[model samples]
Structure formats: structure tokens, C-alpha cells
Target: MANENTDEGLKRVVGVSGLALSIVNGVIGSGIFVLPAIVGIAMGAFGVFGYIACSIILAAIMLCYAEIGSRVTTSGGSYAYVEAAFGNFFGFVINWLFTFGWGILGSAAVMNILADSLAILFPGFANPLIRGFLFFVLIGFMVLINILGTKQGIGLVKLITVIKLLPLLAIIIFGFSQVKTGNLHWEHAPSLKTFGDTALILFYAFAGFETSLGVSGEFKNPKRTVPLGICVGGIVVLIVYMLLQIVTQGVLGAEMATFKDAPLAAVAEKIVGPVGATILLITAAVSCFGSVSADVMATPRTLFAAANDGLFPKFLSKVHPKFATPYLAVLTYGTLIFIVSISGGFKQLAILASAAILLVYLAVILATIKLRMKKQDAGEKTFRIPGGLVFPFIGIAAIIWLLTSLSKWEILSTIIFIAIVCIIYLIMKKFQNKKPVETTLETIL
Candidate 1:
């Protein structure tokens, strides 16, 4: 339970392009492909406004991450930042919430989506046995790729990202020409509750960018790389989301909600007929795989980092002598995803992922404020948010507003999950025979 080893053999080879593409893959996942229809159904033509609002809110949140990520260049992205600002206890809580609560649930949901998407092209994938087999094959491939090396893992992500974007870009380019101006007209503005709910759902599409930073320990010149990569990647995501919404809404019009299951493909079909729909289906599968590939490449580092900090099993921190990767952590995380994906009920739990990620963002934003005030890494140069406390305060308020959109059941579930995490922490602490490190705001600052 001693913090004796920290990033002992992890390579600092990830540069700006690798980091930014990883962020792009992480953010532009299965959610974007289907959320557009839901948003269109909820707010009609005004849904574009919801996308913009979420983008602004996320921009503020990412600014906080940019600052904190630069200041604390460790493996566990959000966990590392909060641990630096606070201490082990809060860090442990965030670790469970971020890594398991959000990461596993979100990725498993994507894996299921991948199976469903593939099933459209090949009906065999619909069978439980075949679907389970597909999950094993895909998950095992990702696990093996990551265990081989970070470079190889990220290389696969890059390939799949390009493959996934082509059909989406094709739809955007062709679908815009087929837009009926009358379809974009609306009679009334959405209510406050409707808009907030729409924005909350859109926020999930942007949530995975933080997971990409989980490999901060393997980043070269993190102070520069983290902020720059986040800025570039964020801009690309905003543009893509805005264009996709405009094209889909403009073409589909009031009937956007009718294709909720495969909205993007509907747009593709409208753009170029049946062939376009087929292409989009393949793209959906590729996009899901790409996102999970990035997740596999990065999120396990949270386990490795936590293990090094003595918060998790020591074996999770072990680096492969040949590959210099956190091989065990990668295997453990991949195994969890496989089990969850094959278990076949994660779609409902996907809501928990949204709630959990909002909490993680809240913690990171708060950590940003505290870390800045305390000047945790005063000796090192780091990116600082332009506004004194304005953005952080805005991020906090925005997160709180989004949390209100959650149903009571989700709220209760998150509370219960946190209680379970706390109990686990206490058990771990007892087993390690170490007293909890008292970490109050006053002491941290």
C-alpha cells in the first residue's frame, strides 16, 4: 500500500496528433449516431440550439481539464488531478466513478451497439450465441492489441476513426443538398425542461474526451500537449456535431424522431438511397469499435495509476517487461467490458454512465479551482484558464443544471453506487493497515 512506484516503465511517446485523435475517437462514438434523432424528436428544429449549448458548457468544462491536466501529468487523468488538489480518499471515489461507473458502462453500451449494427449487415450477429462470440472476439482483439503496446493500440484507433468518419462526412456533404428549407421551421420554442434534457443527453456524446487523458503519464510534454490537444480535438467535435445536426434536421424535418434507432442511416438513405444506409451501418460498427479501441488504450491507465498509488491491487500496476504496458490492468479492464457487454442489459445502465460522468466533471472542475488556488505545481509552467474563476464557476453551474435532468431513480442509483464505493475504500484501507490521510479543503489549500 505504499506509493513507491509511479509510471516506472510507461513510455512518454504520445504526441499531439496521437493525443488529439484519441480524444476525437473517444468523443465521437455511438451516441452521436443515434442521439440526433432523439434530440430532433425532443426539440424539433430547435435541437441545433441544444447542441450549441452543450458545446459551450463542455468548452468550459474542458478548459478546467486543460488547466488541471497540464498541472498534474499523471496516469489517472481526473483521478490524478483530484488527488493532487485533495488527497487519496476523494481520489479513490472519483476513480471508481470515472473508471468503472462511467468508463465500463459507456464502453459496454458501445460494444452492444456495435453488435446490433453488425447484426443489420449479418443476421447471425442477432443470435445470442453468435453475439456473445462476436463480443469475445472483438474484446479479446482489443485487449491483445493494447497489451502489445500503446503505439499499436492507438494505431488501431486511428485507423478505425478514419473509417468511421467517412460515411458520416458523406452523409453531411450529400444530405445538405437534399435539405428542405420548410423542414427546418418550428412553431414554438422548447420549454426550459425540454431544452435542459436535450442538452444533457447531448453532453454524453462529449463526455469521453476526459478518458483519453487517462494516458497522461505516457504523454510527451503534457503541459503543452494536453491543452493543445484538447483545444484542437474539441473544435473538431463541435463542428462535426453542428454540421451533422443541421444536415439531419434539415433533411429529415419533423419526422426525425421516427428514425430514432438509426437516424443517421435514415439521413444517409435519403441522401443517396439504400447503398448509403448500408454504408452508414458499417460506419456505426466502426465508430463503436474505434471509441472502444481508444477506451481500451487509455482507461486502464486509471487502474494502473490507482494501483501505483496503493489504492488498488498491486498487480494491476505491473508493467510488461517487454511491452512496458500496464498489461494486467489492460486485461482486467477488457475482461470487465466483455462480461458487461455479453450480459445484455447495459443499455439501461447507460443512463448511470451519464450521471456518473457529470459527477466526474464536477469533481474535475472543483479540483481545477482548488489546484489553481493552491498552485499545486507552482514550480512548473502550466496552462491557466483565461478567466480567473468565471469558467470554473460556469462549469459548476452547468453541471448542476444538467444533473437536474436525471430521473429520481438515477439519482438514487448514483447515491447507492457511491455508498458502495465508500465501503470498498474502507475495506481496502483496513487491509492495507494504513490510516486514512485526512484531506480537507483547508489542508489541501
Candidate 2:
């Protein structure tokens, strides 16, 4: 693959506000609208603690990325950092793994939106064929927006982010007033297993905060805004997740588990009747679209970076002839989403996304350690990590704990990807070490 991309990728016009909203756009997807019930299934009323714990763990990772982001201003985000620290082969492997996760996630979003939209539009119809067609139409529509222009695409993200936050705000404002202390108390002592399991689920909600970090190359002040966008975005997410959970538990109680599919709307219905639920449904649809948009916008940049660097096919590096977007990479990702949406069940795709993301978290934390150690050895310092070495250790330990705590699919994918990456690295290195012995001897003589 040759490096044929001529356009300097996406133009750098999105300001701090756009980047921050893009972070919110990427992070606050359908996860918050629905995961409370799933979390409640693991630990009942104690699920709020799991949300907070996942936030804390990711906060540490985010700070590490902030420090790491301070150092590198490339478009690839985590992939670029890992490549600088560990070189290109590992970079390609992690990039591939991250793409798998992003694809599954994007597909999950597309399908979720399709299923929800179908229910809204044709309530009694449970036709798979109908839903599948709508999924392509909607997903393709969002991808086409990106193919048009980055500025236009991110503008859409900002709009969706603002619109989607309204229902959540309404939930917090209206639902908290109807609190019941009884629901906050657990029926039994919560098990550590339950806690870990619940945290893994909510971690999915927190997964996409790195959206801003991945766009560093497109930032006007790449070094300064990247850290601010990432840290501020993370803090905002942590606050929202906590409040959303608190009010949800207060409003819904034991039924949180019952309405696990669309818990926020269920909570809203309890707060303000049928109209509230409808509003929340509209919010859910909009929020999920923002997430899908964020995924479509961000993921291709990494793929474009990989392609530009020869880690992926060169054609993927080419900008769209008309739009000047990474149209090939975007389409490739859209195709992956279409396949995953139609072929695999939603639950399966969700678990695979979790596993794929855990691999990325593991890689980033490991890269942070490498960068931090090198800084220490050189007697150089940069952004202060929130708790210094302690934070990184906690972050690494947290990801490991979550990896073990996740479902069987999450566990297997994490292990398998790591093993395969190592094998690939070894084979490549072996080939590099092999030389033409006769030619070498003759040259030396």
C-alpha cells in the first residue's frame, strides 16, 4: 500500500466547544438511556456505586491519556501513542482490535436505533426484515453526512449532543423530587462479583470519552484543547452518569431491572406520565444518533491514520474526491456495522464491543506506564497525573479487574487478541532478522 492521501485529512476548524460536545456526543449514547436496569440486575439498589466506580476507573485512564495527549498531537490518539512507545506492529494490532470494537459498537447503535424507531413507528410489527432495511437506511444516512465534510458532520454531533441532554436533565430535575429512601437500601449485602459485573456494564457507557483525544490532529490548539476536552468531557460524563442513576433508582425502584431495555424512558414515564416517556424516547433516538455519528466520525480517522501509515490498505488513506473526507475508511466502517447489525444479535455485539474496548483500555494504560517511565528516566516532567504513579497503577489494576469481571466473551477476546498480537509480532520480527547469508558474506568480504 502506497501513501497516496493528499488532503491533510479533516480541516482544523472545530473549536473547544465543538470538541467537548463531541466528547459528550460520543460518550452519552444509548448506554445511559438503558444500562441502569442491566446494572440493577447485578446489584439492585447498589448499582449506583458500580456507576461511580467505573467512572473513577476511567477518570484515571482519562488523566493518563491527558498526560499522553499532552505529548502527542497526532490524529490517531491512543493508536499513535502506543506506536510511539511500542512501534508500528503493535500499533496495527491494537488499531485492528479497536476497529473491531468500534464496528461492533457502531452496529449496536444502528440496530438499537432501528429497533427503537420500529417500535415507535410500527408498534405491533415485530418484523426482522423491516427493521434490517431501516437500519441500513439510517446508518447509511449518518455515514453519508460524514462523507460530506468533517465540519458539517461534527456540527451535527454538537446539535444532537445538546438536544439529547434535555431529556436527561428533565429526568434529573423532575424525577429526583419523587425519591424513596427504601429503594436506595439493598435487600442483601451486595457481592463483590455483582459489583464487578455491574461496573463492566456501565464502563460501556464511559467508553467513548476518548472521542476528543482521537481528534487531536484536527484541533486548532491540539496540545491545550485535547487535554481540556478529554478531562472536562470525562468529568462531565462522570457527573451525569451519577445523577442519572440516582434519580432512576428513586423513580423506578425494583422495576429498574424490568425495564432494562429502555430504563430512562421507563423512569420518565413514572415521573411525568405518557408524554414524559415519549419525550425520553425521542431523546434516546437522538442520543443514539449522536453516538453513531461520533463513532462514524472518530473511528474512520484512526483507520485513515492507519491507512496513511501503511498499516491498512492504501486506498483507505485516500480522502473523498469531492468531500475531502476519509470516505473509504468511513465506508469500510459502515459496511462492518451493516454486517454486524444484520448478522449478529445485539447482545452478542455489545459483549464483543466491551471486550474490544477493554483491550484498548489495557493498551492505553500500558502505553501511559511506558511514557511515564521514560519521562522519569530523562528527568523530564509534563502534565501531572491526578495521583501520579498511584493513579496509573490503579487504572491498570482496574482494567484488569474489569476484564476478569466481564462476560466470557469479553474475557476470551481480550486474551485472544493479546496472544495473536504477540504471535504476529514474533513472526514479523523473525522475518526481519532473516538475511541473505551468501549475499551478506560476499558484501562483507
- In order of appearance, the predictions have TM-scores of 0.93, 0.84
Computed on alpha carbons, the lDDT of every model, listed in order, comes to 0.87, 0.74
Tell me the tens digit of each residue's lDDT in model 1 across 238-300.
Answer: 888888988888988877767888888888887778988898888888899999999988999
Pairs clashing within candidate 1: none
RMSD of each: 5.6, 4.9
Candidate 2 similarity to native, TM-score: 0.84
lDDT of 2 by residue, 1-445 (tens): 1112324655665566777889887888766777767776677777777877777788888888888877766677778878878988879877867777555555565566747654885674256677678668877987888888777787888889989887788888888888787888887758877676667677777878775556555666555666777777777877787888777787778777678887888878888788877787777777777787787777777888877776667888888766768888888887777777777565554555666776777788788888777734354444657656887888888878766666676677667766876786677657656656757998999
